[model samples]
Every structure is written in C-alpha cells, then in structure tokens.
Target: MPRRQHITVFAILALFAFIGTSFVLMFRSQPQGADYPGPTSQEPVLVDNEILLGTATAPKLENETLKAELGNAAWKVLHTTMAKFPDKPTEEDSQALKSYIHLFARLYPCGECARHFQQILAKFPPQVATRSTAAAWACHVHNEVNKSLKKDLFDCSKIGDFYDCGCADDGPVKGKEKEKEKDGFKQLELEKEG
Candidate 1:
C-alpha cells in the first residue's frame, strides 16, 4: 500500500482500539459510589451574584439565535458524552466527569444560560457512576430545561436511540465500509472508462 493508505489504515486501527478500550471500561462494573465525590463532599461553590446577574468573567453572548444554536449543540455533546460514560467508571473517571460538567456549566457561552445551567447543576448534581444512570440523569436535566423553556419534552426512554453514537459492539464503520467499497468500485469503473 502507498504511505498515505498505510497511514489511513493505522489511524482506523487506532480509533478502533480506543473505542474498544472505552467499551471495556464502560462494561467493567465498579462498586456504586465507591469513588464518586458527591456535591456535598466537594468544595463549596461561592455564591456569586455576578454569575446570577449574567455579568461574570465569562463573556455574555446575548444573541438569541446564537444562544439557541449553542444550546442545541451543547445538549448534543452532553447527551453523547453521558451516553458513552463507562458502566463502571474508576474514581478518576468519575471525578473527571463531574469536574468537566461543573466547568462546562461555568464556561457556557451565554452568561444567562450558564447561570441557569449552574442552578440546574446545583439541583441535579451529576450522576456518573454508571452509563445508564449518567444518560438518564442527562435526559432528566434536559427535560427540566425544556420544561422551563416551554419546549416539548423528549422521551427519556428513547434516549439511547436518539443519541446513538454508533459505538456498537459490531464497529463504528460498518456503513462507512460499504460506502467506501461502493466508491472504490465506481472509481475502478471510471478508470476502465478512461
């Protein structure tokens, strides 16, 4: 194979390995709450009126259209991340996820939205022990936001179907493989025609 082809194959193999490792980590059951530091255990968040007033250090993005777009995209990322969380995560993984969530709320672009998210986090706290719990928690929190916004609530039971990341046991590229094979056949036909 050409150098480029070799590199592509290697990259695909590496991706498969990483995904496989994630699956293994997710399935390996750890004791419930063995390593998770719940909100009560974590350092207290100082109540800042600036954050509540939408005037914190994070820039206030007030564009309504942009805010909606950002909110939708952020929700997608959150749901997918929770969906992929390990079934039995290590203490480190659990802590990292919880930390990431708090930071994500703090750093969200729209100051108003961030404040709302902070309140939500304060109320819900992240459920990071198992993948199912994490995903369900995400869905519940999302519904809470939707309820506040007067938006239609999503079916939490169908969350797995909605946020399917294609990280199935079979592989991520089954459909891609078929498409690539078809494209290769088309390229061969074109070459013959030429």
Candidate 2:
C-alpha cells in the first residue's frame, strides 16, 4: 500500500482502540457511591429531590458532556435575565429576581451542581437593584463558579459583549417566563405593544 494509505489505516485502528478502551474503563466493576443505585438499576439515586447523576432530565442523560452543556444553557438564561432587568426595579421586581435565583438553585436537576450553587448563593446573594448591577452580579457569580472548578475566569467587564438575549433595547428575553415573571407582572411583549 502507498504511504498515505498505510497511515490512514493505522489512524483508524488507533481510533477504534481508544474507543474500546474507554468503554472498558467506564463499565469496569467499581464500588458505586453511597447514593448510586443498586445493581438492579442503572438510574441514579435521588437525594432530597435532586437527581444525582452526572446529569438528568425528563429525558435520559445522553453522555458525560450533558451536565456541562446544561450548565452553559442555564448560564445563558441567567445572564440574559440580568441584562434585561429593569433599570430601576421596584421592590416587587427586586424580590421576584431574588426569588427566581433561589428557586433555580433549589430546583436545578443536577444534585451536585445545585448544592454548590445554593452554597454560592448563600455566600453571595443575588444583586437585583438595577440592570447593570444585576448583570454585574451574575458575571461575578459565574466567575466564582469558574474559580471553584479551576476553569478560567470569565471577564466580568465584557459580560454584555458575551451574551445576546436578542431583546431589543436591552429588553427582557422572550419566553414563557416573561408571560408571568416571578412577581406576576404583565408580559414584556404586551408592554412593548402598548
């Protein structure tokens, strides 16, 4: 065979070898955590209403990356919410945003991540006084999570540059949540219509 053909074949073999090894390591017999299910079930155990898998949902966990992907998506939602917060929120608005974050931490599907988030929230409570302050607070909290994970910290100064909720004039993100935000305010879209 030509040199190029030989190299291609070797690469294919190496890829297969790597995949096989991964499966073996992943499925190998090892003691499960105290919370892990008994041998009869592959499903994860629930602790205090939190699903303790690497990830979870109404749908099944697809892979190891699902947790990180969900985290990314959740962060996008949060950052955008902060961006669209009212410039001078009323007392109700402030309470609503504060309640939302606490509920988010309590109800997040990932047990481990949710617990950590709850702790973080306790340490650094939500700051929802105004749009800039809210957004800045979100950025700071994200950086805190990053620091704990040993991930590179995000640049808080450029958070607005990073997230685009697609709201016009820095408006609220469109969603079911907007129809009835925590304080039961009128829908943002309807307000725009008036």
Please give the CA lDDT of all the candidate structures: 0.73, 0.69
What is the TM-score of each predicted model, taking all chains together? 0.58, 0.54
Q: Which lDDT tens digits does candidate 1 get at residues 1-194?
A: 89999999999999999999998888776656687655684677653434332332466786889989989899999999986777688988887787777777878878877888788877787787766667777887888899999999987766665776445655555678756633432332101100
| Candidate 1 wrong stretches, greater than 4 Å | 1-56, 169-194
Residue 69's lDDT in candidate 2: 92
Q: Give the clash count for model 1.
A: 1
| Candidate 2 positional error at 15, Å | 69
Lowest summed-lDDT stretch of 10 residues in model 2? 185-194
Q: State, as a TM-score between 0 and 1, how close model 1 is to the true structure.
A: 0.58
RMSD of 2: 17.5
